[model samples]
Target: MTTPLVEMLDIDKSFPGVRALSRACFELLPGEVHALMGENGAGKSTLMKILSGVYTRDGGTVKLDGKPVEITSPRQALDAGISIIHQELALMRDLTVAQNIFIGREPRRFGILDEAALNRDARAIFAQMNLKLEPTVRVETLTIAKQQMVEIAKALSYRSRVLIMDEPTAALNDAEIAELFAIINQLKSEGVGIVYISHKMDEIKRISDRVTVMRDGEYVGTVPAADTPIDTIISMMVGRTLSNETAAITDTSRNPVALEVRNLRRGRDIRDVSFELRRGEILGFAGLMGAGRTEVARAIFGADRREGGEIWVGGKRVGISSPQDAVAAGIGYLSEDRKLFGLATGLDVRNNIALASLARFTRAAGVLDDAGMHQAAEKYIRQLSIKTPSDTQEARLLSGGNQQKVVIAKWLLRDCDILIFDEPTRGIDVGAKSEIYRLLNQLAADGKAIIVISSELPEILRLSHRIAVMCEGRLTGILPGGASQEEIMRLATLREPAMEVRHAG
Candidate 1:
């Protein structure tokens, strides 16, 4: 048998008050795409971090090509032929693609920076990857899919034997994902091992050779991706069989309109967009990336300035010039980037939950009521099944799903009836995703209106009472919840015509 390209045996990792990984083992052979599967907080990322030198392991034996080695830093790991593309991209957006790629290890001639050499080298790498990206383009100007490609290109430039990709397709559209898979196939043909980490089961079945399952910080089992069923893999990860069926949609046509927007226009991204969300309904916003679904959500939540629009809530017109106004009008927004917009990472869970409605927890003497805040936070923690150690736990320490629950708890505590959830289950695992789906259904049953903006068509079809399709910043069409994926795709790609035609009188 050929020697494994990378082997991590009996890996153990811990953080303050949390044992992230224990007795975890993983192996990858040259040219094989090995998938790491687990629920959120199940130690998949922790194990990968240890291998990539982002975290030092408490106990483990790391072997490369039949020899044992200690990788203590990211630089050491890279030098030892291992590269990791993190889930959160790490690029200098202000710099050009070439500058960002060859950041620290730039080729210098005669003690001066070599800009020409840098661009040339980056262009060569892009060409090798079959990517049509200009090295001179600024990183910030690229779409998320393009940025992700750049990250992959940067990792490949290291000429490493092993590459670890964490949810690489989370931000990409279907076409982009297909392109990325082609790139992966090319790399595999070169005999480069890849550790693929993703919550997407279909992608795993399509791309991975073998699958390793982890549960609650321990390795459960390993199986062949082609042989094992997706349900079996999910059962191993979460210790239970998760249903693949969509949530049952309840009729909400009799319910009053909780929120309505008319003639909403914001630059070119949102052109004369309008939608009405009824109480106890989940209005799903579906589109391809850059379809302006998120832009419409942001405009409704008052996160962005709108040129022209009329917003009505509960049969009354409301002026929402900012997030504060939206909140005051009983609206809440859980942004896609939770760390940046949803939660205050430095603060504890209790504080984050209470942040939106701090006035409610304030005493008559104008002093903050710590006990009241904790009580409310604890109530929602159990209510949402947040899975945190305590209300005092920092929001950053929680898993992606748990952090998302914290954000939801914040909005729920504020008593907001209209909630906008943007990419709610983007990075969470299947088990957590099911839980969130259940939560959204429960919220709708409780008479709260929800607007879910998601790039995944399945999610839109599953949760929506009515699916709203957007194409190039316009509301192309709205379909019933039973709309087919083909129909949604057709509506999603429907672009506006250049000019309106009129019959000559």
Candidate 2:
């Protein structure tokens, strides 16, 4: 057998408040897809960053094809045939696809950008991937899936020996994700090594040849994907056996409609979607990504404008022209991109929790009430069991789960009756996910109309009183909460023969 294409030995890295990696080791064979699994802030990203030379390792050696080498910068790593695609896309939104793809290394004919050659090369590559996209299309105009494909195309252009994908399927639909796996398989066949970083367990079993688990900045163990059970892998990642704690929701009969959306249409991306959220109901929106699940949530929250729709809140026709309008109408939105939209990373806990309801904490003289803010923050910190040394801890320093709790606390403090939690537990660990689930149940019990859009089927099946399936920009079906994963997945991907009415088993 050929020597492994890339091998990291005893890597150690540190930051001010964290020892991100400790003697971590990773190996990738020339033609194998190696998956890296870990909870958020478990040093998976840190290790990969060190490998790609974005962060220099304080200790340990990285070997390229059995030969140790110094990779001090991104350019050096790229020259050594290593590339990484980050979770938050790094593309310039205003630039054209071709320009963004070939940004720094644009081919020049006589010292000028070879625009024709750029588009031609881009088109050629896209054709190989079975993607039909105009190279001149502004990245801002394209959907998230299309932009993800662009990121892949960019990574491929480097002629990389080892490619690292961090949550590549986070925003991709089933079809787009399938296309990506096809390309990954093709790359594997062509002797290119891959490092897949994802939280989705099923994907690990499907695509990975080897699974590496990391916890608290240390390498746990490596195992063959086929031999290791899903629970075993999850257990290793969180350093604890996770007993699936998703509780069966109680029957919520006799609840009145808290929110009713009718003919919610916004351009071609979001079709005629309509649904009613009942008080004391956990309604789940299930779909393959780009099924307009998030779009529907955004439209309902007034984050995006709907061309035509009628919304009634508590029997009153309401105008939801903006997020502020929606919020005023008692709608709260927890966006999918948490870091970008959810928290103020630099702010302390007391301030973050009080952010949404600042006016409530103000004195009669219009001055901010610091004492009230602290007391309110303290109440929630204990109520939610947020892990923090003090109420003054920076939001950025907290773990993923705690950060999410902070977001929830913000909305809860604002007294928003209708909450839209989009991928609320995406990067949160198993323990924290359970906590979030319990919190959701409690929220529902307290009569908050909850809309949860999660990609994970088990989550949708567990906490939802009703499940709504979406596909190709439409609500396909709504099923009872006791539905199985297959049942929700089938309807989520189902197109023809719309099952609008819930069918009894």
Write one digit per residue (lDDT tens) for candidate 2, span 465-499.
Answer: 88888888888788877888887778777774264
Predicted candidate 1 versus true structure: per-residue lDDT over 18-98, tens digit per residue: 888888999999999999989888988889888888889999799999899888899999999899998877889999999
The models' CA-based lDDT, in order, is 0.89, 0.86
In model 1, how many backbone clashes occur?
Answer: 0
Minimum summed lDDT over a 10-residue window in model 1 is located at 496-505
What stretches of model 1 exceed 4 Å from their correct place?
243-247, 364-366, 497-505
Query: Which lDDT value does model 2 have at 224?
Result: 100
TM-scores vs. true structure, each candidate? 0.95, 0.90
The alpha-carbon deviation from the true structure for residue 220 of candidate 1, after best TM-score superposition, in angstroms, is 0.4
In lDDT terms, which candidate is top?
1
Tell me how far the alpha carbon of residue 283 in candidate 1 is from the true structure, in angstroms, after superposition. Answer: 0.7
